[model samples]
Target: MSGDGIEILRLGARGDGVAADGLHVPGALPGERVRVGPAEERRGVRRAALDAVLAPSPDRVAPFCPYFGTCGGCAIQHLAPEPYAAWKRGLVVTALSRAGIDAPVAPLRDAHGAGRRRATFHVRRIDGRAEAGFMAARSHALVAIDHCPITEPPLHRAPEVARALARPLGGGGKPLDVQATATAGGLDVDVRGHGPADARARQALVALAGDLDLARLSLHGEVLVQRRPPVVPAGRAPLVPPPGGFLQATRLGEAMLADLVVAGVGEAKRVADLFSGAGAFSLRLAETRAVHAVEGDAGALAALDRAARATPGLRAVTHERRDLFRRPLLAPELDRFDAVVFDPPRAGAEAQAARLAEATVPVVVGVSCDAGTFARDAGLLLAGGYRLAEVVPLDQFRHSPHVELVGVFRREGRRRR
Candidate 1:
């Protein structure tokens, strides 16, 4: 394998530096001349190994994390903030261009300072010693870590918690997935990849939870010790989300997204929140307007319902547990709402978008983590005569390739085509 000096021209979709000859080299940056080894097929693409950066780019900065290149959690930590933000915003731009939809895309909002409120660590017994941390980059090999800077203070202590939990739970050589979520009360931890524990192990786990001062501890959704309910504030109420429930990575990111969605919906009296997880936007919007929250997860909907009922000063906030992927609300059903807000999974709400495209809703707001799927759905709405008002990118998951965006769509008249 010959090491050839290749000049990186741009960053690829996955944050890998790309050469003009189509060579993708990891850990390289644009305007940098890096010596790369022969390309090797990885995940269906031939990627060259970064040997050395012969000429460093002006935009390259020293990574803050010690495990920046080894840990798979972050991929673009070496990039400067300005270039990094531009590359992320360009992800949305490239996606929209590919979908053939032109809209006024806003500058990306930087909301990654609060750090991730949740982290899922891998735990295993190696050489008769318990170890816990994130997996290595693109591999199942576990990298034992003492700390992570990207996570919040509570979540950063997840590795220690995982180790403490594994001592009581793990006897076999199998790896365990420990999900730790930070709450105002304390850390809510969920351990997976192990069978039911015995009476002794359960007691040990209970003691460990007290030692760690965790708000709640669960084993594959089964509660071990619940000192207090892990509650998250939504609009006017505190919602006790289910174990391992989906939440925004950072508190500021959630607020940024919720504010954008609220602005998009305007003063619409009735709104439908589809794929609403734990009422992030639903609860907030319900403060000013009536919101019909629909989601696939029964637990999340239940939490939203309970929070909505207990909370005061909120308008009518109704909910339904329905899979928008398989069965989306039809045009007739959508007509009941003056505005609609949907935040689907990474796969996106394709079927729901089709229905919304056909519906004559005055205002529609779309929130997504996947740019490709968002653009596809936006194109469908554009083809159906909805005007793409704004697309704002949010750096929720910083130092990583993932980006969240909120798209505003409005249709004044009847559906076209």
Candidate 2:
């Protein structure tokens, strides 16, 4: 496969094309035959560069972003809509199949509307000017980008904002992590990787924030200056999230997940939202059901509590700041709620899922950004007598290899006494 060409059979889990002889070629799509260069083995798989495309797949399409082939920000942008959607949904299907959880998987939802609201840019000084953009695929080299179409219009201001704070934030000599989040008020910028800022640097950042008209700016988790609170809508209330807080990548994705969670819990009077981040699901569910929002982030919980209190006509929403991984709610404690919704991080909620598996809760909905972990946790629930009703995949991060899903599980028969 080195000197000769190889036929791309299918797209692998990492969005690379796999050949019949098991060679992985980046930038090659399925149903296409391509020539490959000498291979380098990484993680026990032979990876080769796509040298020439002798035949192109029908599903292949021109990428919208000029930086598509170089930037690691997106993969599969070259695919047509129909095949792209199929490949994305196939990720969840394969994961669940491997876990032996056979259930009805719904068609993938297009949650990539208007692009993502958050972007973490990589910034470094080159020559005398700051260069800000995404990293090249599987390399430390940075691809300087003038525009990013996959992000919201406000997030396109990241490069300018990064350049403004580069010098003041001590970013000349080292690379800086510039995380910009688009909020209702304005941009919320969080600068990391650079050393802590001093009083003088703090003053400079404050002035720069005003100049940029930024809503808030923080350095290494410390607020440098805040013109106004960065608010995100959660249900009927607006929540001023903590700097660098976890919110859905897109509002469209949040709405889809919330809708599924609400419908999964049905008309239950009481619901427990695990790993609730600023009440993305808790607050929405509270429109009808009394919600107990539990999370590990104290700041996020505080914001949720404030919103829950201020918002009128919502069912009581109580919050607890506890690490579910270290101390998950036990079966006896979980028995109080009729329905439970858990949206854990990429690692999934194994400890919590183990307990929820045995709990008497009639309904359990699992929301995950990782299909492998979701299937793993789903296996736990299935082994405990829970029936997996349905699994829905949502494409929140479009053109990227990552996939998000919501799984609904129900207890088959009588609850364990």
Candidate 3:
């Protein structure tokens, strides 16, 4: 609570209010319309209430999805497109500031709601019928819909095809993660496995692949068959991902990330790339830089090695399939590096981050898809005497709450503060 002129309610990073009197108000996450009392009523428990402005600061328009309030897929669709992009950029700067890092922030371009190559929709049997759509925003109940504009045409076909197959998903079926990519061969479907659709269900599954003209087929957790893309000079990096292997669903997004990672390393001669999956960043970086990639997936590494052998300039890339969670690279072994880059999963890197703080690397770049976890790991780097320099947020998942950001961190000068 401030002086007699104006009272401060809940202090926010952007000087906003979370709530005034514990009443539930909606609109915009990390946003609240705070109450400002007149000079006369400065004292007391600050128990005043005022109408909260939940709009996107005059920068956002109402969302298009009717199930926006109930669907878990999107969080910011309600925002005006321009303002939504601005808010995301601020999120990146704010995250970097939290890490005590201040560098040049870059403008995010092409922030649109298109080119979604991958999507996952829920499958449910409604009234003894297979219906496909997202769930209610806060509930697991299905909002059966045939088409999702955000998804690519082929991926959107998943729901209708599911209904045609009428596959029985045991226990009402669970969430299905369907990934797709546009390549020279055509659109490919990478269906991530889900619940068991019994023997009767298998018939329905096959019908889906055939009806949709899918270039690839996959069961729960398996890739049945994939239409191989034309092999350009894949460089010494393996691009043949195993059935469940993690491949960049979007080529454009992956290229941007890989470029940022390579630039972040500065003049790194020998660097360690952690959580290196199928050399997404590692192999790309290896085109010019030397890398010792660390990951837990042996199969993924095997594929990457196979790619490396085929690549001409891949002599610089090496990999070790180690469980960094159980055992991280020791400081002595890592002390020789000039820079480091890590693109960890949603969990972020807790143990690995701690070990990185003490490492002798100069520049460290961490790419994260999860904001909260990025903030957490950035905090660790800040404590380790690294200055958060730059953060670039990518709205790869449009109309959704998810944000992908890349932050470049630099080691502070060796002066004890």
Candidate 4:
């Protein structure tokens, strides 16, 4: 572990130098040296020359989870905060660059502390009790915990109830994920029975509902009390979200997003917000212009309706709950808008990109999480007579590889295709 000289494993999907050892051995990262193997074993699984993995930090405060080393959930926890911050920033810039979009990622922005408003925790019955924790990396295993270092404080108290309910099910207890959402009212937990929550499981969950100071309670996948019904941010109307709706993790994140959308869209009067879940961008866009929000989920469309009614600023939000992937917006449909502000899921906006390329719309603001998908879709847009305009990366999750970014694109003259 001397001067940054080490063998590289496979390049990360985004090209970060992966460890040659194929494991994050407690105190190592990219740019530090790690001694590998017993001679003959070193030649396994094609290697790269990124011999610069990093070593652990002095303030590396031990990760609390027992499964930290094996769990795939976090990769850079062992490194010092300084390097991990850089890695988080890297995910954004690299993703934007690969998409060939205009990303002005000069002064990287970082959001820290305990403001993560939502987290989905899986629950299971250990020996005689239920254990609750996050899903380990890519596996079904739950990383059981007493406290999660990264979540808001209230979340730590939830496991107490989770374990009590899990105690009865014992070895046969089902697996469930608790989504603690920070709504306008307060923190609401919606429980979805993922693996094996049964009719017998209802009582435990009901008791759990009584223990916490939750605004709303849900058990066995059903809403129990209307302590605080879901609300669309703009409107006072109740938002009936899709079964697994996506909600922003923080109020700051939501407000910042609205600001970015308003700034990016400029003065475009007619616009489309694709994958418009509860009108995250569409509702914001409605402040200045009429926006057509497109999504496939019926519940989300209902939420969109509720939001518009409550917030008059978003009165112009019209929704189409049609699956964009199956039936893309036609050329006639495209002609109605001058721009687009789309925030698609990690899958990226393949179908919408196809239709937008043929449109007269001049601007497209894309917010994406998956790097490869963004690049692929961007390539399609470029082929369709558009050029990358600007890129902005969001570091919402720290000490982790996952990053969010916004890429701005504008229509250019056609050439090849």
Candidate 5:
């Protein structure tokens, strides 16, 4: 295929370079000229494979990781720091503008302290050996790796551990996913994609755990061996999260988000934490104010309750397990709380936001990972006469296109049409 020289204009949401004619070239940076292969239409956009960089951009820098283009984990690592931060902050501004909102967005904050504390490794068999690593970009093929540079020191050897654990379950003849989390005790691991283990397999796993010196090991949420509790620190309390449960990517990221939440809920006596997982924000808020944490996962809620009960000097901390998507807390129940803090998944809390719009809560703080959904929910709150005070974007997952944000809204007056 003949190559064509295309001038890169800007970056798309996924970190791909865009041309004036809407052509997307992978691995190309803005303000550069790149040679690309034959173009093909994909999902209503023209895309081409980057052959070579004829003229590199001034912001381009050598990637630190060896698996820069191969591994699907990090993107936009080649761009300089200033441009990278600008692009990340621009994502929030663009999303809010599209949602018809005009709010002051703070600069992107760096929260990638000590790198990621948790990671999931994909295991697969090739030519009679089990290999563990991340998948290729936009491909199902595995890119076997020895170590990942973006993870914390404790998780540096997670790939090796995942490969060893795959041996017990047919040497990864079937697909397997190993999730490793670095805790205060030791490495907490969970294996998935295999059915229940029998007596012999379970015994082998227990012995392997002993050999690996793992704090806890589980298969599909069933404990195999627990030498010590995998305790993770949240505020003043310690929590033992459930097997393969959700957690913030980095330790510093969680602390930064919790700080913002506490500051946003200033002077509020009663606070309600929605979608509170393992009491990341609730436990911190309970230091002074009474907190009522509501979540869908019973195990997570149980963990939060245990942490709250075990910790001393905390205020009244209560919890309830309910799916907010199906039935959000109505205005009557929400009116009792002075403020509401919700940190939801990528889907955002549309139902709960609608209900909060109807309530008279003085303060509402939203924590989200998706800018588009956050903007949509912010619009809903604005329509209900809530004024968006501030929106702060945090870069927890460094080098990735993803970003996390926190938005504070205050009720201006009565509900508007």
Candidate 6:
């Protein structure tokens, strides 16, 4: 512990304040003098807990959420809007600079419309009753809450629903994860962590779903009860996503990303949507151009196919179930599409990027939630003769360190090889 408070130099990737000596202080803002306890090294970085803020930064503001500090869900709720946007945008700029890719990074766009539509609440038996809420910051300890303010208004009751759902599976005995998604029909919930539910547990869950008037309830993707299909609208199509399916955190975030993707595709007659999840982009793109949606998840692909077939007036929407990581679409396979749009997981589409690098795809749009991985993949594309056009950063996960980005690339001349 330093007798004199340490000065915070900058914000780290994980929203922690970094001192000049490389000490990472949690809950400390840049340009602020913060007193921290003795540092301990974790994951190669020396970290300390912020004990006091001797001098507060101008960018610091009072957090709106009462549970902001205790809950692990949000990191930078105290930062003012201007500096917060700059910091979020800087994430993409810093990442691209580190990757040695010189590109025009746009300002941060707020896509957190109506807040997050989906949230995962951790359920555990505390004292005598089942409690549902988020985990404490940097700890496994649960912070029970009545509701989360950052979520959509409909999902404010998600914590209560999660608590009720956990009661059937021996609420006090085992820990459970309740993933709730606000859909058109109603709340779609999926419970995990508990093993296979027995006949009695299944009956209890089904009854509870009926009582709660839930759209659907599932255990590990297996439907326990479905009062109605959990439909989520993507553009003009109504999609019933698979149980525990991956979706953009916010409805507006999906639309924003899809808009960027469609605009990047331009006048392309054929497009390939790689790593497409439940046709978030494919169904939308299919309205104008022929789309070939490729994904590893069969359930997601099936949902996309069903939605596409049910919706009229959409151009041909073909799909394929392929593990892109294991076997990326080769150069020859990619030749048929005029443009390629890939929105991979946090790991990014390194293998697909390699293949796209070899291919002569006129236009390529890469959407990623991880800036570091996006920058790395952009480097591969740039090395393969693709000119980095523009990069847009979107803040969908408000008050959090996570930022989504969409990068546009165009093939210039020939490949380096």
Backbone clashes, each candidate: 0, 0, 14, 19, 0, 0
In the range 53-99, model 1's lDDT, one tens digit per residue, is 99999998999999877888898999999999899999999999998
Model 4 off-target regions past 4 Å?
1-27, 35-71, 80-82, 92-104, 165-172, 194-204, 219-221, 230-244, 414-417
Could you give candidate 6's per-residue lDDT for residues 79-139 as a string of tens digits?
Answer: 8999889999999999999999899999999999999999999998899889999999878
Candidate 3 or 4, higher TM-score? Answer: 4
* Candidate 4 Cα deviation (angstroms), residue 51: 17
Question: What would the TM-score be for candidate 3 when compared with the true structure?
Answer: 0.77
* Cα-based RMSD of candidate 3: 6.9
Ten-residue stretch with the least lDDT total in model 4? 38-47
lDDT of each: 0.89, 0.89, 0.63, 0.64, 0.93, 0.94
TM-score on alpha carbons, each prediction: 0.97, 0.97, 0.77, 0.81, 0.98, 0.98
Supply the TM-score for candidate 4: 0.81
**Candidate 4 per-residue lDDT over residues 319-414, each given as its tens digit:** 888888888787568767777877888888898888877776778887777666887787778888787776666666655666767778878774
Better of 2 and 4 by lDDT: 2
Q: What are the per-residue Cα lDDT tens digits for candidate 3 across 29-104?
A: 3343333333222233222333333332444366776666556666556556665666667666776567665666
Q: Superposing every Cα of model 5 onto the true structure, what RMSD results?
A: 1.7
Candidate 5 residue spans exceeding 4 A from truth: 1-4, 415-417
lDDT per residue for candidate 5 within 211-266, as digits (tens), equals 88899999998888899989999999999899999999999999999999999988
Q: Which pairs of residues clash in candidate 5, taking residues 3 or more apart in a chain or in different chains?
A: none
lDDT of 2 by residue, 1-417 (tens): 554578899999989999888889989999998998899997899999888999899888888898988899997788899988899999999999998879999999999888899988989777778889999988988888876889999988788888788878666567898899998999999998888767898898899999999999998877888899888888798887888888899989999888999999998899999999888899889889799999999988988998888789999899898999999999999999999999999999999999988888899999999999999999999988899999999999999989899999999875645
Q: Where is model 3 more than 4 Å wrong at Cα?
A: 1-19, 22-62, 96-105, 108-114, 164-208, 227-238, 247-249, 414-417
Tell me the lDDT of model 1 at 247: 91
